[model samples]
Target: MLSRRHFTAALALATGLSVSGLALPALAQTDIKLTLDWRFEGPAAGFLLAQDNGYFADEGLNVTIDVGNGSVEAIPRVATGAYQLGFGDINSLIKFLDEDPSQPVKAVMMVYDKPVFSVVGRRSLGITEDPKSLEGKKLGAPPPDGAFAQWPAFKEVAGIDDSAITLESIGFPVREPMLASGDVDGVFGFAFSVILNLKANGVPEDDIVPLLFADHGLNLYGNAIMVNEAFAEENPEAVKGFLRALAKGFADAVADPGAGAAAVLARNEILDINTETERLEMANEMNIKTPYVVENGFGGIDEARLAASIETLKISMGLQGNVTAADIFDAQFLPPAEERMLP
Candidate 1:
């Protein structure tokens, strides 16, 4: 007794047709932009993995990772909405806060807690045993943009005359050669990038001792995850999604280094990644050594740690009259331990 029209429509409805009642499937993931602290290299393993393994997509995000010239530009770029997120140092962030309190930036997660900067010195220069030995020695360092700007605090803590050391303005590429050929006593450099590479090149570790900035009162976060006030407020879900994917990437990198190195290499083919041992070591250091990065957990910011960094930044950067940590940083985006899934 069913008419042809009714029969066909009833069959369509029974066959899972759109009966004007059921909801449609969810849409695809959203896209996001993230910036890195340094050029594309092995250090950016976690970020590379997140993109390669579709972690961001899994979290409903499409991530675009941009290479940063340095922390100086990257942090402010994020703070000003040039990018949605940034990875860099706490010192730069503190400096920015001091310069302009209006453009407050907050770290959503920590990456490297340990200070990577160090004073690379030759043993022949009588720079041995500890930082105190560097007193009265002709110490060399990279230019103002280099780590030397933070050396004042270290020198003070080490009991060396602020003027006892001669800080040469040799750029980054010249650091190793200047020290090797005896053009200078040693150089200040990022431990992982310069010092570690030197060691890997058959240079004896004892030949060059790294006076870590952290040991000499230069404790600050390195390679942190930060965002601007506006982006953080308007697009919190996007920020959270990016962080979530990054957290998984970090966890994966620490858990399996072989895969991590591959992830890094995939992002930047120019990296001299031939040394497997060095690459693994770098990954481990980034994950475990830094204070900002949690033990057995994702990166989380600590107020006490931030307070310490604030004081260090003020003294180290000679910004006593310039800025405060509270001026530049906001703690709101800093997810709690529960959110970080810390063990």
Candidate 2:
């Protein structure tokens, strides 16, 4: 008769079981559907890179990425379980959580340390290099725009009288063109998106002045990776693996934004490589690769700063609820500190 150990080993080999007689499950891939906050632009290259490089596959995940109409729209998609994951504005997620505290969606990673919110105006339109210049100017704002949603907060901090400004509701497709054609004196939008879109619409880059909200007393963090609470609860390992793959992709993008942009171009062949590359670089410098992110690593937030942001949001957005930072973000799903460090 064969020894017990040898017999067990033979049984393991015959049944694809462990030596301890535990049946080994097949390596099953988790299916994840991810929605982006916007089109496949420069900033989206990192996710594309992750997909192209098989980062998701390495973690036993099969991720499908879809373009979204806007950052605000992404929150609802994830909250409704239409998407298992999303890249969206954290502020929008906070507002959604306040309105429906039962919604099982929370930000898992901090992608943009500095909010990309800004007011892009033409210097020729009397917008001189000051936030006060926006007073009395006609501003184009998209109703669903993440930046525009925060305008009340911006108005409060910049000390601008709401009555002094004429607000024109415009669609995203025409916001840049309208600004370039002088249809509006200024517009609220993400700096990187608006700047390049304006340039593409024939606006002189020199004439554009971007008044960043972060510079003007908005301590809010920007976009992050948000996950559906139910999906995360059932598949914590999958969630962690998703973040790990995403961080790897981000780190790779930081090392070579050109390569990252190329990955984006592969997905949408109609995009102009040069323009998208510039947009990606701009987003990295002004939003993603901030000093704080460099020091603390990516995929995490500073608790103190996050609390202060909640207080600012409460005052500026006139938010009425007992919502706190914990409700909006759960950093527990983030990858390890070392794995998130930029190259």
Candidate 3:
């Protein structure tokens, strides 16, 4: 015969409960602050899904994600420790590392295998489907845009004469509006964003022509998940766990993009679900779910291709620093292929 306290303890153990009749406490979750390359739009659905679906919590991580202005802004924010992780342009990260060579930031996960960089133009503005249609025409581009930052590379690869085209520096908010109003012949931007924004501004889809840089000659990788190198060095397991959760989120988003877009809408009530759904679907099919990604799995890059991209940037952008692909990307944190593969 056991005493009352001993009996209660035996019962608690048998029931997988504590002496106080409560479940055991869970492990402490690691907190992470993350930032995105742009607003809570379609492509941001995966990260949002990871947060809302408890994927991050499953990895014992408490993540707080914030919308960012652009990839250029995101790089410096992560490097400066303003954010622990971010989604940003890999080319932009390359340039940053070249300039400083000591910035403790590197891309750990490749998101956009096929970049969205493009030059969008209105057909009525004497811009046709040809890459050279903009000769002697004004091209509007936001000064800090990731697509515009790679213009020189695109120009070199496409064999376009720089002297024949006039460059017009435009703010991001006005890029599409100005093109719709015939204020500029063409604008440089992400293909998905420019096409949708043009349509939203009343420009018919048929009237808009997108000259995708990737289709032409630039084989550059686009945005990626960047981590502060210092942070990664100190917390390797946490970084791996983050990527695992992120891969799961992406896999889920690829299966049913509408669910991913809904995840974004849950966070931002001002967004239009129909439009964002379309955008998310477009991004999924065109960028995220490419045949290469489908074949090789997500979050890993081909070294030879990445090296070629670095060489292209060095020549086209007049980069003086001796930077290599190794300096800009670190694949150690990527989840295993079996885990990242899509269903």
Candidate 4:
């Protein structure tokens, strides 16, 4: 007895047609390479959870998630097809597309609805919660850090006078240490990450101050799941299925961050379960489960807000007026809102 695939091949061979013409994709698993914006920390549990629970497998996908150097680094990796999908800052994606509208990449899912971009500083070093406090301050900024990349606009919206402020070039490894040692008054990075790193460096909680760019009226979206435009065009269903699985994964993570952190621990035993769990909870409250997400469900964006964000980018990132919000994000790949609701 010939299997359906063999029968389809036989029929297609006789009919002078391709096997695909005889049968649509059924149980065939598509291969996907996914790049994460950063290390396998607490926030990554959602992606890991989906993989561990076989959500991607159930969706007929063989997905491999890789740790990325930075959120900005994932853009080219996905654009050039070195990876089929990635989690990265959508603001950076906007800049990438603006430089060349023909780039084969676009955001498919909104993970960090409010964004985690922040300038974390220590109050003991003359820094405070007020964005205006950054004036005359020396701040550490990693060149590839997603949060630092938003400085131009962040400074503009936050109304900080950079003429008096100095930016110190630093690496990711030293961002928190530099701030903890008071070598630099503040650092540009994700809010939760910088906070956690400072805590690990022994900075007191009372001294740590995270000034989020979004709260200063940036209104920009944050990290999102981006796809290779070519791959998405070729396998639309696979993309949809991948997003569906991620939605479930994130929901589960939100429902129980302890389990989510456990998933992260399963990946890297060196990580402290307590620290990772706290990290996941912080991400859930600050970036993921925003009022908008709670109301509209997850993995979707507001067209008007996205459009306004592009306007903000004009001043912040110096976009070339080459692409619009619609050009950067495609909501068609997301599952239905009802299916994306968080716990």
Pairs in steric clash, model 4: 153-316
Measured by lDDT, the strongest candidate is 4
Ten-residue region with minimum lDDT total, candidate 1: 287-296
Q: Cα lDDT of model 2 overall?
A: 0.89
- Writing each residue's lDDT as its tens digit, candidate 4 over 73-139 gives 9999999999999999999999989998999999999999999999999999888878999999999
- Per-residue accuracy of model 3 over 254-296 as CA lDDT, tens digit each: 8878898888888788877888889988888878888889898
Per-residue alpha-carbon lDDT of candidate 2 for residues 1-343, written as tens digits (9 for 90 to 100): 9999999877776766786656654456899999999999999988988999999999989999999888889998998899999999998887787777899899999999999999999998988767899989999999888999889888898887778899999999999999999999999899999999988998888999999988988889999999999999999999999999999998888889889889889888998899999999999899998988788898899978888887888877767866888888898888778888887
The candidate scoring highest on TM-score is 2
Sorted by TM-score (best first), the order is 2, 4, 3, 1
Per-prediction CA RMSD (Å): 5.1, 3.2, 3.7, 4.0
Kindly state the number of residue pairs that clash in model 4.
1
lDDT of 2 at 289: 85
TM-scores of the candidates are 0.81, 0.93, 0.92, 0.92
Off by over 4 Å in 1: 1-29, 138-140, 144-146, 200-202, 270-277, 286-296, 320-331, 334-343
> How many residue pairs clash in each candidate at the backbone level?
5, 0, 0, 1
lDDT (10s digit) by residue, model 1, range 146-249: 35656776676667765576666776666686777767776776666666666655567778777777766666666578887687778777777777777777
Q: How does residue 329 of candidate 3 score in lDDT?
A: 86
